[model samples]
Target: MKSGMPAPDGIQPARRATIREVADAAGVSRSTASRALTGRGYVAPPVRDRVREIARGLGYVPDATARHLRQQASQSIGVLVSDLSNPFYAGLAAGISQQARKRQYTMMLADDGGSPEVEVEAAEAFVALRVAGVIVTPVSAEVSTYLARQQIPVVEVDRQFSVGVCDAVVVDNENAARRVIHQLLDLGHRRIALVIDEMHWTTGRDRLAGYRGAFAAAGVPLDDSLVVTAGWDVDAARIEAHKLLSRAEPPTAIFAANNVLAEAVWRAAAELNMPIPERLSLVSFDDVSWMSLVRPGVTAVAQDPVALGEAAISQLFERIQSPHAPVRTVLLSATVAARGSTAPPPA
Candidate 1:
């Protein structure tokens, strides 16, 4: 064949070269070529070099999927998150990807958009792909149970639904919420509104518990009407905020359970002409860029999402290495960023 030309045996340039071609060119058995290329069972240095040179010349590439199937384990790990658009999830995914690359493993990512059904589907897809393990911010316990039954190593991040069944990495949500709420109470805020999306998951449930705990600790009675379940939609949260602020006995302060609820509260306060920390105090569980950039920075409980992601991956690798080992749950602490948004309730 001419230089840079396709093989004369009808093999097109675009066609993937196979191990058989490499073996034939190297004048070796397929097993010998595979051992040399994969660094498996030993082959003579000279013979290995010769085989590699022939593979390079023929543009031969081994199929990782095929190799993984034969070995019954993949070098790829699956990561499933609720929402990629949220900065928290984005940062978490970046951390996971970085750690995965460092371990010479490929990452397969899936966005479930915060839907339990979608999360389950993604888990099934990961199984079909033969991923060596999974790291997920689970929406429901079903995903974890499914993966556990399949014998796939799983590490949960951000939230935990499968305690004792899989490893997990998360912030101390309940304590963080209690600390932020205590700050609001110390500012002489009597009537505080607790705004959250849902209590179905541990994140929201723990945060709500903290809010109530803070009130009880302060000898303050919580008004059931002040606790609003705004659901996951931002628009719904905004509407809920409007209703809360418009009440005859509107809260003097608002404790938003997450970043989304925080934004909704901010918007509602603006629409009602209630300037933050002036007419009404505000606090949030998660920190966002705008939280600090606004005229009066919003006080928040800042969780290290990236660190959480990295921890999840580290736990995943441990599970992969020792599948029968005891499951671990890592809890990272969240710090309170006391900004201008929180202060003594208006006189």
Candidate 2:
């Protein structure tokens, strides 16, 4: 391996082909080769095809970072989500990737695990990478505030923390939740319970408002005790749900605010040997896969997460195009997928 010594097998790692090499081989200037390969400028058809063929044969790949540096702009966007392990987030990310690619913008995706420190770190990294804009389901207002200070356009997805200060794309949480409760009320469920993790975010707060609103619309008083604050994990939620179901005057129906909570409730019901709809009615806000795989499909408020992602990218692109435009909040709709999970209370 000494310098210029005979190689063991006369083999060597192939060097990456550069634009200059391609230009020299194609008998053209570097700028013309660039224009021909990227189709960014005028080039005659024959010359363009010949240059492209030579570039391909040489396995030449353009340097995106250098191109962005030359233009003083990036053709990339940053996407930050709370949790990617969740199917909802995964679907949303997939949709965003598809839409961003369609517009020729590369997406740089990150998961913050709902941590403020991690989110701040990601924000700093995005700025360092020279991303054109950011789309995030922020853990707090700080992410948007920091990006705004950096003069980077941002769009919040799924939930909002900065309100009018940032663009957002979210579903009609209140109306969708209210409609879910209405269905329960119409079915004569009086002592209904709501199992939720926290009321801190716009998602939880709005859904709670809708839950209470439904009772108000029905002229029924809400029992505050029934609003159980469960923890984020499944075991914690299951314990809370078990306690609620074990009450002497247990509710006839339970409304789980999300899929994880719904899973906890379902597991608790199974442990208690309660036949769903026959004794305890279950409704979930998220329509996940397992909800339908069960014997009795869970009644759910279905949000099109893929469409949600598409909407977020669209909003982010708009923000990037018009940084001075008025901030906007686009609210998409959800539908009630009434399955076999809900029924009139026993007797």
Give the best candidate by lDDT.
2
Model 1: pairs clashing at backbone N, Cα or C within 3 Å: none
User: Model 1 over residues 199-291: C-alpha lDDT tens digits?
Assistant: 868898899999999999999888888888998777889999999999998899999988998999999889989888888999998998899
Per-residue lDDT of candidate 2, residues 31-125 (tens digit): 99999999998999999999999999987889999989999899999999988988889889999999999999999989999899999899999
Where in model 1 is the C-alpha error above 4 Å?
Answer: 1-14
TM-scores for the candidates: 0.94, 0.94
- Model 1's number of clashes is 0
- TM-score: model 2 vs. ground truth: 0.94
Residue-pair clashes per candidate = 0, 0
lDDT for each of the candidates?
A: 0.91, 0.93
